[model samples]
Target: MTESPRPSEGRSGGAQPAADLARIVVFAAFTAVLGTFPGIYLAGAAVPIVLQNTGPLLAGSLLGARRGAASVLLLLVLVALGLPLLSGGRGGIAPFFGPSGGFLVGWIASALVVGLIVSAARRPTLAVLLPANLAGIAVDYLFGVPFMAQAIGDLRAAGVASLGYLPGDLAKIVLVSLVAAAVHRAFPNSLPRRKAAAKA
Candidate 1:
């Protein structure tokens, strides 16, 4: 007779989906909560500096690519649905077309890049996470700058204006790297299993 699956195996398998769902939901809510802190608008730039940007960084580091993107998407969906889930109590389709819109959309790609890099690492150390998170921010800027330029009709000006975000973004990189590294060290299993395997 064929052997039946072990009880422990069954339990772990059954619980994994639920655990993933819970994590996704929680991260979505966490991102929304970050928006509660008001955004700071620069002297002349339309895009504001906001802590909500860090949400994608942290989610990606902790959840890996697919789940990380899912978490960001969840929050965006709420914002799209007219929920006041964005900084400055802004939400709905309007934000998606505003100057900050590209950056908001970039959050998904940012999470994907960060999670992919982190997942490739054997261990999520600060060394690995710092660059990974920085790459994620670069991806955000790639999408954002062009869109902002389009909106304002000045590519050079948009690029220069985006420089204002550097100091805040750098601080976020350090904070996310430290926090992600600690969490990975304390809970190794938190890393997604499928992508954790390093290719030869």
Candidate 2:
């Protein structure tokens, strides 16, 4: 007679999709919660420095590429639906057309890059996560600067103005790296496994 598959094996396959869905929902909600924190506006600056940016960094570092990007996209979809899900209760298609629009759009790419970098490692450590998070921040600024330049009618000034975000962003990188590293330590499987190289 054929034997039944082990209970553990049966459960593992079924549980994976549920776990993935749960993580996606949790991170998306986590980002929305971060937006509840008031944003900091720099002197004479149109855009505010917001903690919500960290959500992508954390999501990518913890969830890996596909799920991380999905989380950010989910939040953006809600925002597009006119939910006050952004910092200071801002939302809708308006924010997407505003000075901060590029940054918002860049978040998906930033998370994708961060996840790709971190997942390359066998284990996510502080050193690996730090650079991964920094790269994500760079992606964000890349998109944000040009949009701000266009909005303000001053490319040079927009570049300079973005400098104000450095201090806070650096702090976030450190914080996220530490947190991600700790989480990975506690749960080794939290990050995605690196793909094996194909045979020639």
Candidate 3:
């Protein structure tokens, strides 16, 4: 009679919960560090050209939803505490209430959405990248537009101001997708395969 393998074998055999948690912590720190780049000051507005979104996107694509969201949350907390870890090295609660505050708050949701989509979709091909990035970017705008409108109390003004940033944000999304694809290829094992495992 052949004996069946123990529960600790096969899929559960190599699972390391502690190591996974440690990796999440380390990646969260890395996300915060990557957010320290400065923004470009325009005529009457500040345009952030930092690699901030890239970090969150990559974290989501590589860390799965919960850990990815945790990373963004940690970064946001640091910024709220005046860490000067945001674009243009701007931090403190003031930014959280400023014109760009909505976008800042939305980043967490955006990362969550991106990570969720990436995990749920199974295949991370080009088709999936477009929708994933678009959803993530849309989440950012959803928060940003309303906040900017409230800050200025002029819907048209807010929309026009936001237009100045559309091109840049789109470019950032493109770059993020590219980087995500590369990471998926080279470090496929980096992200936890919750969706795939379940389907299997």
Candidate 4:
């Protein structure tokens, strides 16, 4: 029986592992910056909503699945540890289990989903980009709305409350996708290079 050769033997070489780790760190820091940026604020809800999804979207597009998820989870851990890494300087484990809990969880899941889509697409033009952002938005809404309803004890009110932020969220999705595409063009190898090399 023949055994397949290891990746380093066939590809870039022994340095690939270190290179990959460096990319992971860079992406994680990028997400941290986006998460910490205090964007538009939605007050008086379960927790104030901010245009922080840009971090998840950009991470997924540029970092791909595993690493993108890691970036978001890293931010989550920081927030949970009371680092005030979230938008408007909100943090702590309570937010994770509070009204904003689902949205927080959604960040990880949505990053994964976006990464899966963007990675599979190989080359993300504007045509293919919006859908990926929408997927993350849907995930955010899927988890967030229910939690809001539960927390506020009124589904209608929660739905209405969420509407206030819809425009801002949509705007963030567009901005993030454009920036991600630009970064992808610039970095080219920021994401896992498997799919891209295959296409090339």
Candidate 5:
């Protein structure tokens, strides 16, 4: 079996890994910054609605699958270490074991899926980008619901509880689609090189 080339083995190879690493760190920090903004915590909701997910979306759209997922994983690791990186400065092992744990696990997969879509398409416009982002959102719920169900002890009820997040997630999809598409179009070089075509 052939191994994939290392980042250092590619064109402009020496700096490729560093570049990818930088992008990953930057986006992880971006998500952390988003979390610093206020969140809406519903009385019955297990997790607060925050802008943190948007960071993963942008990282995926611009950085491709691997780096995008890495960015999420990085942020999660920090949270696990009790860095207080989450929205409202909330983070720690406690959150992971709480109702929000599943969603936390979902972030990595969500970013991978979103980046794969953009990479597969070769050209991502708002029309296509929004749906891809929506799919990522769905991926998040898939991971979240089961964990929530386990915590709540009612599978059906967990699904019902997650509904409150739909509206906010939908808004994020729209906002991310616009911003990602614009970034691809206006400053294509800013995005990771695998996907997201440069504006002609």
Candidate 6:
């Protein structure tokens, strides 16, 4: 009879525990660092348009579901601990209570969702990339818009202000898709793979 493999065999067989920790830390730090890029503050908007989303997008596509979400969560914890880790060095508990709070909340969740979709895709074609990125963004707005509206006491205003993210987000979608596709092809093992559909 064939013997079953040990606990750490198969899927994560060759993975080092330290490497896993490092991947988490590195991605978290990378996201925080990217947040430092200067953002464009609109004339009358409370939040600025930033490329901060890039980090999470890359993390999700590269790291897979659980790891991606973990990375984002770690960064958020640091920010909550008063580190100036967000765009324009905005961090701490204050941001979590502001109009942008919901979007922030959505980050971790969206990363998980995006990672699942990205990693599970057989190939990173437009069919997969376009939907994955847009869906992730929609999830962010799902949580973001409501909080924004409540904070400002006007859903209309919040909806209007959110339009500012469109162009930038669309750009991000394109860029991330291209990068992810290339990386996925070159290093197929870098991210998780699509699971086979269960047979009847």
Top TM-score prediction, candidate number:
5
Give the whole-model CA lDDT for all candidates, comma-separated: 0.84, 0.83, 0.73, 0.73, 0.80, 0.77
Model 6 residue 183 CA deviation (Å) reads 2.5
> Which candidate leads in lDDT?
1
Cα lDDT tens digits, model 5, 1-200, are: 01122544223212456676777788889999999887777665666778887888887887777778888998999899999998878888988998859988998999899988986775788877898899888999999999999998999889888887888899899999999999898876654554223322
Candidate 5 is scored at a TM of: 0.85
TM-score of 2: 0.83
Residue 141 in model 5: lDDT:
91
Q: What lDDT tens digits, residue by residue, belong to model 6 across residues 88-119?
A: 88888999999889999898888888888876
Tens digit per residue, CA lDDT, model 1, 1-200: 01122334223212356676777789989999999987777676677778889999999999887678888988999899999998789899999898768999999999989998987787789999999999999999999999999998999989888888988899899999999899888887766664224222
RMSD of each: 6.8, 7.5, 7.3, 5.6, 4.4, 6.1
- Relative to the true structure, candidate 3 reaches a TM of 0.81
Sorted on lDDT, best first, the list reads 1, 2, 5, 6, 4, 3
Local lDDT at 114 for model 3: 84
TM-scores of the candidates in the order shown: 0.84, 0.83, 0.81, 0.80, 0.85, 0.82
lDDT of 3 by residue, 101-129 (tens): 99888877887888778877766765676
Total clashes, candidate 6?
0
Query: Which lDDT tens digits does candidate 4 get at residues 92-184?
Result: 898877765877888888888888888778487766678998888888788888988999899998899878778778887888788888877
User: Candidate 3 — what's its lDDT?
Assistant: 0.73
